[model samples]
Target: MRPPTVLQGAPYPYRANSLNLFRLILAGTVLVAHSFYTTGNGEGPHIRGENLGGWAVAGFFVISGFLITRSRLRTSAGEYLLHRIVRIFPAFLVCLVVTAAVFGPVAMLMQYGSLAGYATTPVTPLQFVWSNITLYMNEYSIGRTLSDLPYRSVWNGSLWTLYYEFLCYVMVWLLGALAWFRRSAVLAVLAFVAATAAHALESVINVAGLDGDFLLFLKLAPFFLGGACVHFVIERWGVNPWIGAGAFVVTGALILGVPGWGGQASAPFMAYGLLWLATVVPQPRWIAVNDVSYGFYIYAWPVQQLLALGGLGIGGGALGLIVYNVAAVLLTFVFAWLSWRLIEHPAMSRIRRRVVVPSRTGSAAA
Candidate 1:
């Protein structure tokens, strides 16, 4: 069978498939992975060295790389940046306010004697909302809010990745602005190779006990670049099920066989596999219609923390832990749905109206 063709110069068909559902599943995987820690049980399952949450996050970056690159290509820089701001900041700001001002203060009162104590806490304004909103420069907790729990101190542990996601977005914009993306295939190939090499070097450095924040970026950057490379080659490669299956098999084998090098080795395969599943797999209509993934992802950690603070698994054992996780999942979904309908969607629509600009393509591209 001939490979399917996706024109490189064409705008990415954002509504063509069920990428929304795929992202939701990935977000759900992150929730499940965090359950182990949130419930004070243990770490979740890992394939090779990366845990389920890590894999899901990598998948998110991959998809972002592909879609955002296409978005930048099809629109002006100002418009691209505006869309990103509208997509990320409004809902994120809302979540920050709810978590820091509302839930966080309450948790603080529960932990400390008075609201005065919460107000005087160092992390209350500085790290919690200010740093996170500015650039995610600080960690994701305020005061001793969740300190009493088994997990301790951390509020929304899932947020560290947002900084890296934004960093990737900036990188794509810079590269596109420099005309690197407009060059011949050789530049794309070189870029991909450089990313892969950097990832490999990061793994080596990690093994050598020199790991740090910068190394974390190095580790995840390859997956993002791999997705971009796939987009560059989409016209030539298409959505071939056989090829996707083959890639999945290879990735699984590498993860199982060379557990240490598995994640780095599987980066390209993971990108291709995710794309294939997003594009080729049959999607339910309901999943296609609603996109609660971003909301779910942003709210889940706090919801789980709230449940834990409410005495979820004090002495309840395994059964109690299970109950807590299940409840958290359900409540998280509700919160996500509400966020999408009430905050995220409406905000985007309003922002679009205010910041309207004609695309360079002379048509709106998804």
Candidate 2:
């Protein structure tokens, strides 16, 4: 017998795809990758000059770009922006508070025997949370509490990406809202190609004298734009195995052979290949039912940091590494679950209920 293809009999339920589970795995990849360095093991592993965490972040951006572009087309600009903000900000805000109030205080307690003068310390807990309330991550530590950790003075190093992610959201918000762009998603495809070229030649571009400071944004733009391009292709072609396989091959070459900008340049192909895999995999029901990847992502670095302070993420020989990974994974999961149940889920639900998300197809990506 032949197997089914293209998912949901060619209707291709985007919301029903295994993205949730896939995202969770990406989050885990970041966690494990960070575990290497956060635990003082050096930058974990690398592919094409990117650490595992960097690769995972690229993965997140690729997927995110696809879905967000789809979203902008379906909703009013206001609705799109609102959903984006709500989706990212509430949980992020909570995570900041937890870091400043909970994680920092605990670390201080462990190191200094008290939280005395904690609030007044430079980069105080309030300052840490407030300064970064907008998600730019202006402050990385609270009251200098993390000064002793091997990763020193960085509370949640993972968070720097969130600012970039949100910036990408705004990029989609602006570009997708254009009347002409909305009418022709090929614009998205073109934009993606342009970005890909830029990144693929990043080295030559840098040598030619581009501003040094804009490198980080340039590093991520292609992937996000590629995801947008992938969304266009999926809507037009459905999910064919032939094209998907080809995409994977191209993605592999772009990511591995091209180093530096290779990962960024491979964004569209990578996203398409991942989408194809999502359709083929037998995903668990729980991940679909309760999306915890965001929670997991936001909480992972802190969980690792806490472990590092406890001597878990550091110098864990095979045995210690095993224990640290186990304990950190378990603890991060618990926090993620709580964050989803108590904070993220409820806040999103309230915003969703209060707002009528102008949907043309009556279906939305989760």
Candidate 3:
């Protein structure tokens, strides 16, 4: 394919992309990846030190970095935060409540004897209110819910990343408030350096004394910041398909060839690849109109666990896995669609209408 012409010195065209569909596909990727863990004998697929779910999470952070930065730039801080709150919390609160009150109690009754035990458990109410209220500080399970399942007690392992995602949002907002986004190129370079250094440090030194979650945040921060860097690159130099293609080849090679730090090394290239797909890939118009990705992402893990609890994958083999994943995907889609229609979209629309901002001059923010 011929390289698309570069459009330098122009505003970044965020709207001319299929990021919504891209995120949906990524969410589905996570579900598929987790299916191996949730189904059958619960022995997940071993893909040579790589996890598709990890990649999907990385993709999420990248997109969030790019889009949220743009969002913060175009609006007042209050409006920006309002948009973030509405976009994330309402649907999430619903999920938390349902999981804690409905699903948790049901699972507890199935596993134990009565709802009294669940009600008496402090973690139950704490899981519901604390997670929804704090946003990042999450409680995955409520009183032995999903305990009978193979994964055992973890209601939603997928949620840990949401904490980091929210952290990235706050970081972006802080940077924007500090005027770093206005000088995006300089900030991107610094962030890129910091990310690489952190990865290198982790790979070389024994940081065993450090908090595991903090260390993990250090590792994943690169992808998020690398995404922001890519946004700067696109804004400054524009999208050249040849550069993207070259990046893809180099990063793919690194991922395949390098040991230990290959994934971290490939963040920039992956960020670029995501941009290429977002901008250059042709997507169906329907994909652009309805965004069920967030719902799918937030709901899939619990749905998978519920299916497992229901004995959908007892056979312990490929057939069992296929059955479980198919069932999970179908049901998860239904929930996602319902969430979009009933909760997320309406909340966003209402919030947007209530909090009006000045019109931006350049391309529409994604």
**lDDT (CA) per prediction:** 0.74, 0.81, 0.74
Error of 2 at 4 (Å): 19
Each candidate structure's TM-score, on Cα atoms with residue i matched to residue i, is 0.86, 0.91, 0.87
lDDT of 3 at 200: 66
lDDT of 1 at 136: 72
Error of 3 at 317 (Å): 1.6
Error of 1 at 353 (Å): 7.8
Best by TM-score: 2
Candidate 2 residue-wise lDDT, 37-82, digit = tens: 7778777678866788888888899999888888777777887888
Runs in model 1 deviating more than 4 A are: 1-13, 109-116, 125-127, 183-185, 203-211, 259-261, 351-364
**lDDT: worst 10-residue window of model 1:** 3-12
Residue range 31-100, candidate 3, lDDT tens digits: 9888877764654554437688877887887777777866777777887888888888888878777677
The regions of model 2 sitting more than 4 angstroms off are 1-9, 200-213, 353-362
Rank order (by TM-score, best first): 2, 3, 1
- Looking at model 1, the pairs that clash are none
Superior candidate under TM-score, 1 versus 2 = 2
Error of 2 at 219 (Å): 0.7
- Which consecutive 10 residues in model 2 have the weakest lDDT in total? 1-10
How high is the lDDT of residue 118 in model 2? 97
